[model samples]
Target: MPFINTSSPHQQNQSSVPDLMRKVLLALIPGALACLYYFGFGVLVNIVIASATALASETIMLNLRHYPVRRYLTDYSALVTAILLALALPATVPWWLTVIATSFAIVIAKQLYGGLGYNPFNPAMIGYVVALIAFPQQMTQWPVPQPGGALGLLDVLLLQLTGTLSDPAILDAVTSATPMDQIKTGIGLNRTIGEISTGALFGTVAGRGWELVNLLFLLGGLWLLWKKVINWQIPVAVLSALFFWSWMFNLYDGDLYSSPFFHLFSGGTMLCAFFIATDPVTASTTHWGRLIYGMGIGILTFIIRNWGGYPDGIAFAVILMNMAVPTIDYYTQPRVFGHQDED
Candidate 1:
C-alpha cells in the first residue's frame, strides 16, 4: 500500500478558483446592467459571444496541451476574462472581432503563458489592445446614447453580425465622439477645457452616460471589497494617484486641463483601478508593492490619456506595470518569521 504525505497546518477551506471567479462575475453584474441600460442589449450580446468563444478556446487549448479539459474549464477563469474583455469593448463591435479578441485572450495571453495563475499579464487587456490596433475604425466608434432611447435590440444585433445598418443614415446620427476623444481633439484645436466641456456629451462630472456606468462599477468594486475578494490598497492607490495628478495639472492651468472628477469618472478609470490593476497573478504580492504597482499604473494612465496618442491609456498602463510586478514583488517580499535582518 502506498502512503500519502500531508503538509503541516493543513486545513479545509471553502475558498476555490471557481468560487472566486463566480464572485467576480456576480460583482460585475451591476456595472454590466448599467451599461445595458445606458448602452443597449448589445452589451449582453457581446458577453454571450465572448463567453462562448473563450470556453471553446480554452477547451481546445487544454486538449492540445494534454491537460484535462474539464478540470481546467470548470474553474471559470477564462469565462471571467472573456466577460471583462467584452465589457471593455464597444457595444457595437462586430461579432468576428469579438471572437478574434476572445480567442487571442484565452489561447495566446492566457494558455501560451501556462494559463490562469501563471499568466504574467492581464489577458483581457491584451485582447483589447490587439483588437484596437487591428481594427481601429470599428473599435473607436462607440455608439452615442440617445436621450430617451438607445439602439433597438434587433438593430444592435444586426450591426454586430454584419457591421452595417439597414439604414446607413441612422449610423451617422447615432454615433458620436466619446468624451475623452472630444476633449483631446478640442484641446488640440486650442479650445479651453471649459469651452469644450460644455458640449452635449459632457456631464457635470464626466461624459453624459459614462459617469453613471462608472458609478455602478464603483459600487460593484465596493461589493468585491466587502466580500474580501480583493484588498483595498490597489484601488485606493490607483484612484488617489490619478486624482492627485489630474488636480495638479488642472491647478496649473484651468483652461488647459479637465478636473480630477472628470478623469475619475471618465473612460475606464474606475474599471481599471478596481478590477484590472487588482489581478493577483499580475499584481504585486506584498502590501507595499501593491500600492507602488497601482501608483505606477495610475500615473502612466494619466500621462497617456493627456499626452499619448490614444484617448485612454489604462490598457497600456496596466501592461507596463505587469512587466514590473516580478521586480516589485522581489524587493517587497514579506519578512520571514523567526528571522532578523542582517546588517
Candidate 2:
C-alpha cells in the first residue's frame, strides 16, 4: 500500500502565495490613492521604480541562490515589499535612492535571509531604515503637499531623475518640513505642544494633509480585517498600547506631551499598526505572543518618537520588536492536546 505522507494543515484553503499577495496589494490601494492625492504623482513614480528594482533584484538573487526563479517570482512577495518601502519613502526622493533601497530589501533583507518566511525582520522596513541611515539628507527631503503649492508632477520627476532643478529656488519653494519634522523642531526650540499644534503644519489632530492619508490607511486596514487577510490581535494590541502610552504622557504634562489623537493620526502610526506589525511570517505565530509583540512595538515606537532621536519611529520600533518574537512565541505557546501540565 502506497500511503500519502502529508503535512499538518490537511484542511485546504483556495489561497496561494500569489493570491494572498494580491489581496494585500488590494488592501493598500486606498492608502496609495490618498498619498497620491496629497503628495503628487511622485508617489506613483516611486512605486514603479521600487517595484521594478525589487523584481530585478529578486530574480538576480534567486538565480544566485540556485532557487527556481519562476516559482518565487510569480508569488509577488517581492512586489509587495517594494510597494511598502516606496510608500514609506518621501514622495520626491531621488530615483537612485529608491532603486538602492528596493534592491537591498529584496537581495539582502529577504533573499539572503532564506527568502520570505525565514527573514527575521520586515524586509520593507529594513530597506527604509538603511536608506534613512545611509542618506539622511536625501531621505528627509519630503515634498510639500499639493495644497501647499508644491511643484507639478513633471518638475518633481525631472528633479528626481537629474537631481537638479531649472531654478534651485523651485526646490526650496516646493519642499518643506514634514509635520513630524516641524513638531520635532518646535520641541527642540522649547515650544509647547499648544504652540506647535497651532503651526501651519498642523490641521486638526496631526499634519495638514497627513490626517487624511492616515484616515485612508485606517480604512484600508479595516478592509484587511474584514477580508480576513490579517488577524485582529496585532492591530488591536498596537493601537491600544500606543493610545495608553500617549494618554499617560499627555496627562502627565499636557504642555510637553502630545495628545493621543496626534499620536494616532500622525506619520505612519496607522500604517504600521495595521500592515507592518501584522506581517504573518515575521510576527509571532501563537495568539498570546502576537499581542505581546504588538505591545512591544507600540511602546517602543512611543518612546523613540517622544524621547529618542527619530521623529517617527515605526521602522525602528517594528525591527526592534521583530527580534523579540521568538521569546514571545516560546512563552505563549499553546499546550498540546493530550499533554498534561508538568508539576
Which prediction has the highest lDDT against the true structure?
A: 1
For each candidate, what is the lDDT?
0.90, 0.88
Ten-residue segment with the worst summed lDDT in candidate 1? 141-150
140-245 per-residue lDDT for model 1 (tens digits): 8887855433688888988889878878788877777789999999999999999998998888889988998899999989999998888999999999999999
Clashing residue pairs, candidate 2? none
Positional deviation of 258 in candidate 1, in angstroms? Answer: 1.2
Per-residue CA lDDT of model 2 for 212-303, tens digit only, reads 88898999999989988888999899999999999999999988888998888988998898888898889998889989998999899899
- Quote the lDDT for 224 in model 1: 92
TM-score of each: 0.95, 0.95
Backbone clashes counted, model 1: 0
TM-score of 2: 0.95
On the 0 to 100 scale, the lDDT of residue 320 in model 1 is: 97
RMSD each, Å: 3.1, 2.7
Where model 2 places Cα greater than 4 Å from the true spot, the runs are 1-11, 147-149
